[model samples]
Target: MSVHTACPVTTRKTLGQVLVCLGCCCGRTDKGHPPVPVDWLKSEWKRRMLPKKIHLSISGCLGPCDASNVVLILYGQEAIFLGGLHEETHYLALADWATDCDHQGCLVPLPESLEPFRLERFVDEPVAAGAA
Candidate 1:
């Protein structure tokens, strides 16, 4: 839960400027890879949220291996999925949708190529909920 770290106190940060930071957060697998597209999507939101520095990384796995093909968006405010996807198109669509999300909690809708991988909803604290 405490995966995200505050930037150096002396340095400045913004809301939108996020870094996926690789395994700064984590999943359960030994091969923990922060889902790339979701992380990429979050970083793009810096312009809108003006995070000054939005930070994204893989946190612990929200289980339900069924949901292993999952992702968190907007620092867990919303979660979505890679729906029957492979890394290439999956990451691209996620980044597109998340970064373009507006204040209304609505994302700009997924790209045509990624239409297949969109998940309707992401279960909360999926790991605890027994996502498998």
Candidate 2:
């Protein structure tokens, strides 16, 4: 039996991307982490027509397993890391943020509701004095 089926694939142009991590820790309610609202997110993304402006990908194991329920937003050259999104409101806020950015045709500041979820997983090294 053939397990795979062929399907048409089309490349989409998007202004940014949102990556939701459903890793071992994330989306595992049994492990004490909150459930990821995958269905709601997908519905919201489609309803808002975000596929044309923002690409949404539900991925697995985005690292930093310590921070469950992680979401990464890539806008331009910036990668924003958000963690501890354990609430339905957080997902709603994310949808809203993406919709606003799409409407404005550019990245916009994160709404207050999502401000608390912002996290810094990577840090840049400082340049040495007169090293160049």
Top TM-score: which candidate number? 2
Model 1, residue 123: distance off in Å is 10
> Model 1 RMSD to the real structure?
8.9
lDDT of each: 0.45, 0.88
Q: How many residue pairs clash in each candidate?
A: 23, 0
> How many pairs of residues in model 2 come into backbone collision?
0
For candidate 2, what's the RMSD? 8.4
Mark the 10 consecutive residues where model 2 has the least summed lDDT. Answer: 1-10
Of the candidates shown, which would achieve the greatest lDDT relative to the real structure? 2
Pairs that collide, model 2: none
8-54 per-residue lDDT for model 2 (tens digits) = 77666587999999988999999999999999999989988997798
C-alpha TM-scores of all predictions: 0.39, 0.83
Candidate 1 lDDT, tens digit per residue, 72-118? 44433344444334464566554555455534344454567766655
